[model samples]
Structure formats: structure tokens, C-alpha cells
Target: MWFLPDGAGITNWPKGPTELDALVFGHVFTILTTPLPNNQFAGIVRGYDNLIELCKRVEKDYFEKVLEH
Candidate 1:
């Protein structure tokens, strides 16, 4: 599992695909310029199936190829 707090690095994402079993994005909205309340910084936890599927979709749509303009 991985916990990404506000302003974390994506450069290490490649390292994660193999190491992480469950990735947790913490305080996602808190990273925005208009910061949310500390209490509002919720954690999103996805299961294995959903995580794998999400990764696949991201790879297919964003990482794997260029879009036709």
C-alpha cells in the first residue's frame, strides 16, 4: 500500500506498480491552491481489482499511446 500526501512525487510511480498492493491517495483535494480543511482531507482506498483496472485504464488511455488531435 502507498500513501501520497499533498505535493507528493509521481516520478516514483513506476516503482509502485510492482511494490504497491494497495495505493492510498491522501488529501488529494488539499493539494489544490484552495486548500480544504484538515478534517476534509479524506483517504481514497481501492481494492486490488479496482486498482489493477484503474492502472490498466490509465496506461491504455494516457501512458501507452499518444492521442489523435
Candidate 2:
């Protein structure tokens, strides 16, 4: 719902005032609160530990099973 970006000021990632579609995207961090009923917000979380693993695999040089997501 609210987070600080690596570049600039704080961010509140909600496209609308509705309960749904609320997410925060930061350059170095991501924060999401108020879970959705469908767990749709799941897997969208970005953790610091994932940086190495993620940076190691780039879309330009990587492929995966469709079900991986």
C-alpha cells in the first residue's frame, strides 16, 4: 500500500480507491498490505534475497516452463 522507492519519495501504489488493485512498487523495495481475497497479490512480492537470483536470470537470456510463474 505504501513504500519508499530507491530513486525518489514515498509511493502509494493504488490505481483506484477500491479495495482491489492496491500495490506499491519501489526501485529497491516493494510493500503490499491489505491482502486480496483471491491471493492475487501473491508472488508479486519482491524480496532482497531474490536480487542475486533474479539478476542472474535475465529475460533476454533465460527461458522457463510456462508453469513457473
Using TM-score as the measure, the top candidate is 1
Off by over 4 Å in 1: 1-47, 66-69
Cα deviation at 66, candidate 1, in Å, is 4.1
Per-residue lDDT of model 2, residues 7-47, tens digit only: 44536555422222122122222323345565444445435
Q: Cα RMSD to native, each candidate?
A: 11.4, 14.6
Q: How accurate locally is residue 65 in candidate 1, as Cα lDDT from 0 to 100? A: 71
- Alpha carbon lDDT of residue 43, candidate 2? 40
Each prediction's whole-model lDDT (CA): 0.38, 0.34
Instruction: List the candidates' TM-scores in order.
Output: 0.28, 0.19
lDDT of 2 at 69: 67
**What TM-score, to 2 decimals, does candidate 2 have?**
0.19
1-69, model 1: which lDDT tens digit per residue?
233332455555544433332232112222222434653322232233444454454456555577544
Task: Give me the overall lDDT of model 2.
Answer: 0.34
